[model samples]
Each structure stands twice: as C-alpha cells, then as structure tokens.
Target chain A: MVSATPTRERVLAILDTVKDPEIPVISVVELGVVRDVECGPDGVTVVITPTYSGCPAMKAMEDDIIAALDAEGIGGARVRTVFAPAWTTDWIPDGAREKLRAWGIAPPGAAHDDPPVQLRRAGRVRCPFCGAGDTTLRSEFGSTACKATHYCNSCAQPFEEFKAI
Target chain B: MSNRFFEYLLRLGDDRLVLGHRLSEWCGHGPILEEDIAMANIALDLIGQANLLLLKAASVENAGRDADALAYLRDAREYRNALIAELPRGDFAFTIARQFLFSAWALRQWEALASCRDADLAGIAARAVKESRYHVRHSAEWLVRLGDGTEESHARAQDALDELWRYTGELFLTDAIERELAHEGLAADPSAFRSAWQKDVDDVVARATLRLPAVEHWQQGGRTGLHTEHLGRMLAEMQVLPRTYPGARW
Candidate 1:
C-alpha cells in the first residue's frame, strides 16, 4: 500500500520545523521564499526566491531548511534561487501578521488586499512599546533594511517598525 | 551601432558607479543610525546595478576589459556620466534631492529600456526597473517629509533644489550616440522623456509645498567628459586604493 502523502508534501511538512532566527514567530514557509518543492527518484529540489538580492537571511534560511530536512531522513535536498517576478511584502502569510502583533510589534500598514493605488496612503502605525496609536515617525530608515524607528507619544518610548518596501 | 550600444551602457554604468561611491562615504556619517543603514543599502544597490550594466557593456563591446577594468582603469576624461551624478553629496537634503531627481528619471529610463531591441539590455532593464521603482519611492518619500516638515527643513530642501537645478537639463540632452540608438529602437528619445520627468518632479514638489527654481542657464558637457573640479577629488578618493595595489584583492 502507498502512503497517502506525496514526497514533496512530506518535505514541506518537515520544513515547518525551521523558525526564523530573529522573529521566531513563523517558519520559513510563512515568509514565502519557498516557492516550490519537487521530488524525484534521485532526490528533492527546493526552489527559494530571495526577498531582496544579496539578503543575508537567505543563506541562513537555506542552511536551516537543509539541516531540518536531513534530520527527517531525506538526505539529498538541493536549494536553488530564482529572481524573476521578484518577491514582495504581500507574500508574507496571515499567520505571521498575528504573530507580529502578539510579539508587541505593529503589523506593517501595507496589507496584501490593498491595491497599488492605495500605496500612497500614510501609514498609521501603532507604537510597539506602549501599544499606543499616537506614535510618530522618527526616521524612515531603521536598524535593518526592513525596519524603521518611531517614537511613541503615549509612553515616550522609541521602537522599531517594519517598513513595507 | 554596437559601439554606440556599449557607449550608452557605459555612460549609465559610470553614473551609478560614481554616485554609489559618493553615497558610500556617508555609511557611518548619516544624521541618524537608521538613515546610515538606509544610505548604505541604497549605495550597495547602485553599485550592483553598475556591475551588471558594465559587464553587459564589456560583452557588447567585445573589449578585453571586464566590469572591473572598465570601472577602475578608466581615466576621468574617459568617463561619460552626466554632471548630476558626479556632484558632491553636499548635505542630507542635498543627497535626498539628488536621489529623488535621479531615481525618478532613472525609473522612467529603465521602464523604456526594458523593451530595447537588444536581448541583454532588455533583460537587464527588466531586472533593474523594479529596483529603481523602489529607489524612487524611498527618495520621494523623504523629499515630501523634509520639504513639508519644518521651516528649517523646507529651506534646506529648497536650497538643495536651487543648487542642483542647473544640472538637470543635461540629463535630457540627446547626443549623436543617443540619436543613432533611438532610430534603431535601442533607446528612448531624450526629448520625449523630459515632460514625463517634469510631471513626476512637479507632483512631488507640489506635495512637498516647495517651488522650483526659475529656469536658469543650464550647464552642459558631462556627456563629453568635461567635468567640474569636484570630479578630480572624487576620482582621487575612489581610485586611490585600486590604483595603489594594481591587482590586490581582499
């Protein structure tokens, strides 16, 4: 009797064990870099797209994916990068958004449901420190390429907000 | 015709290479830490674009030189970048203004370039247009905030506009190479690009509550490689390490 689950599906199931080092809220799959999974008689090939070219996170993510799947008894896994139709913030899963809010960080103002025309709207981000909606932008650039610094008026604390590129 | 194609690519690549070098100098000196990282990120993107385009230029020219040779070994007079890209990174406001202006124009240029007759140019343009779109957005966002934020910021931004305005005209000046390329469907008409660029700048400026400088005598000659005194200083800094150790690599 054949097992009901396909090999590719089993590989993805194993990948869910790997968590993002910084956020630790979601696995690599929620990040949307895992574009496709293919399994053959020889081995399994994983196709991942980078959020940004030369992103440092990509190397670590690749290693984590490989290590986790190898522990699951699938030894021949190959990772490849694709650049066409580049990855966007919209690809981030809904589960990650909930995790971010629970972690005391404001979910990014840019949501996937919004059209491109709505991109010009001013982002009304709540302060991560005091959970206040009256935070003001201190600077557009942040500690990382993905975050920005903002000061909360309520608690008088400064915190980082993830900037939607 | 192929020479012209290579020439066009070199001009574009050199603009990015020089500006990237200027922007990198601010890696640690930005007004804030976030901005410091932001400028560094933008600098890296620009340098990456330069390498891609320069490599394409070398392949098209079939010259023995690769991207590195074309970038480092070339003399000041050999460079064909416009004056706007070569100007000093004067102040934070100045840097933002330069980026806003260049990125807007470049976004349009890359949009048109994506459909070039050459397969390589089209592919490169397609990849680059997305990056330039983000660059324009980032720079334009800063332009709006600084221009409308406070009296001091408004004045400083306007001053940057005034100082940099003279260099904008040369960006739309068509040359013999451009003319030849356009006829072959390999380039965009510079004149056709001006009005669109104007509309873009005007919309941002209006939103920022700022005004443009009155049309003034426009400077020219960067296309011909005749540069201001600043180029000498910039080249001295950028090429010094490479020139000192001819083939050394880290």
Candidate 2:
C-alpha cells in the first residue's frame, strides 16, 4: 500500500536521480527543470519547464521522469511542461555551475540585469577549463540551442558557453 | 470568439515553423563551421517556439489536434506563414538579410505580446522575446559585417536587401481579425510596430553601410493563407515523412 502512494518527497528523490540527457553530470533537479511536483488524489503531476523551446532533450526528460516514478512503484504519474515563468540560467543551482564548468561546458555568465540593448555586446565569459577571461564569441549559436560558441584565447580552446537566456 | 485568436496563433506558429525549416537547410552548408552551428541553433529555437504556439492554437481550436498533427499534416494552402519566410535561401547574404528583417520585427512583436491580456500567450511571448533578442543581435551583427566587408559582399548584401524589401510589407499588415484582437488587448497590432522596426532596421543598415531600397510595390497575402509557389515546394519536402507514414513516431 505504501508503494502505491509514494510521498512527494520520495518522488522528488527519484527525480534527483534523473540526469539531463545532454549534460549528464547534472540532474534535472539541479538544472531547475523540474518546476513542481504535486501529489493529488488522482495522481502525481510533475511540472517541467524546458530550458529552450526547441530543446530536443525535453521529450527524453519527460520520459525519464515517468520511467523513474514507475521504477519506484509510484504509478499514476504524469509529466507536464509549463513555460509561464520560463527557464533561465539563473535557475541553475550554485553548485551545478561548478559541475558544468568542471565538465568543460562553460556555465552561463551573470544574469541579464542590464537592459536588452546592452545584450548585443558580448558578455565576459571565463574559460571553463583554464579559468581565463580572454574569450571571444565565435557564434551566438552553439552545438545546442542553449549554448553559444566561444574561443578561449588563453588556452586556445573553442568551448561552448551555456547562453544566459 | 476564439476563432480569431486561433487564427492569430496559427499565423505566429506557421511563420516560425516555415522560417525554422528554411534555416535548418543551412545545417552543414554554412560558409563557416561556426555559422553552421549558429544557424542550426536558431532553427531549433524557432521550431520550438512554433511547437508551443501550435499547441496553444490546437487547444484554442478544441479540434482534438495536437501540435505534431497541425505541424506535419497541414497542406500548403492551409499554412499562414508570411511570404518572406518561404523565399528561397538564396546566398549567405540573402539568408542573413531575410533573418535580420524578420528578427527585427519579431523582437517588437514578441515584446508587445508579452504584455497582452492572454496569460498563456503572454508567457510564450515573454520567453520568446529573450530568444528573439539574441537572434536580432546575431543577424544585425552579420548584416554589418557582410555589408561593410569586401566589395563583393557589399554588393551581394545590397542586392539581397533590394529583392527582399517587397515582402516586408506583409509583416505589418493588420487585418480585421488582428485589429479586433488588438482592440481587446488579446493580440498586438502589427502596424503599430512599423516605426520601431524601421528605426531598428535603419540603424543596422546605416552601421552596415547598406542602403534601404525604395520599394515601389509591396507584396502581401500570406496571413490570409495565400502563399507563393515556393511554399508549395518547401511543404512538399517538409511534410513528406508524415504524409507518407501516418502516425510514425521517433
């Protein structure tokens, strides 16, 4: 009977084990993709927000959530995606930034406190591998929709920087 | 009535879908490796936005159609994307010019939509405004570089701008449906964006050392489901898979 109705905390713990498909080092929880987890008489509904609208990984993440709950014997689970608050790099936990940097993908720079007009100018991005500030934007778009390509002059490495948006 | 709102959503979604498809064509064919990745990334964003918008449209229609069904099953005549989106990806200059013009206008459209009365649409717009901001900056920078670069690049950029100017009018056309939505604060009046878009485009063109051509005749009709021949061919390629194999999933 306990297995049939898992607590929200238990569901969350199971979700913490679900890693982002693209960046395997961080769990979706750490990435802040899991927006909400509501336990109701009907079922458990997990609300997720996509990092980017077109991110191919969203479908995979949704499936993983359902699978993880099912594996834990927590049936009647549903995954819902919401875009109201919208996902931002700011949602990434403090520790996850270091994890992403150590994994070689430069985490996003500081959030856009400045107006949008100033965003046209490239922000200072430190090299994830070398910790150097001398980097130039190679392209606004990168290997993934959530990233931008940058060339680190200090280490002579072309790296992907998770875009601040 | 929800009919106008449904139509409005389709207009927004179809534009992004068709434009995304066009940009996706540059996946491995970009002039530079960086450009290849950049174009693909933008394509992903546009397509993603299209998915969300179409899903909202489907819900509004309440016709039991999903985003995939609307995106993959729609015929060419049924599509409401602007003619500018369907124009062939000519050269790098042409593609960049088209993107610049579209992004400039889209940035403002999304900004207005962000504050509209519809919460769901506002949410989508709020998120898209950020993406569109980046897109405009990227394309604007490229416009400057290509226009002010080599002699050949300058001429190509000029020529592309001239050819594409005629289609820009369609973007700002406000039909009865849009006017009604705008009056109700449900949708933005595209005509109101003209001055801002012009200023934005003019600033970029001046910095790029390119001239805005004197467009004599303006082409319009994509909003009403009338499209150029180009859309038919593009749809043939885009819709082939779903049309051939019904209910095929990845």
Instruction: Tell me each candidate's TM-score.
Output: 0.75, 0.96
lDDT of 1 by residue, B120-153 (tens): 6675666566566657777888888889989999
Model 2 lDDT tens row, A31-126: 889999998877899998888878899999999999988888887699987778877889888799889999999997766734333326655789
What DockQ do the predictions score, one after another?
0.17, 0.63
Candidate 2 displacement at residue A84 in angstroms: 0.9
Q: Identify the runs in model 2 with alpha carbons over 4 angstroms from their true place.
A: A1-4, A113-120
- Candidate 1: stretches off by over 4 Å: A1-29, A34-50, A53-82, A99-121, A126-132, A153-157, B1-3, B55-66, B114-156, B179-186, B206-211, B214-216, B246-250
- What tier of docking accuracy does candidate 1 attain? incorrect
List all candidate RMSDs to the true structure: 5.2, 1.6
Question: Alpha carbon lDDT of residue A35, candidate 1?
Answer: 86
Report the C-alpha displacement of residue B212, candidate 1, in angstroms: 3.3
Residue-wise C-alpha lDDT for candidate 1, range A47-140, written one tens digit per residue: 8876544255677889998888878777758897654445666777777877876775566666332221111437668876567888787665
Summarize candidate 2's per-residue lDDT along B92-208 as a digit string, tens digits.
999999999998898899999989999989989988988988888888889998999999999999999999999999999888999999999999898887898998888889988
- TM-score (chain B only), all candidates: 0.97, 0.98
**In every candidate, how many clashes are there?**
0, 0
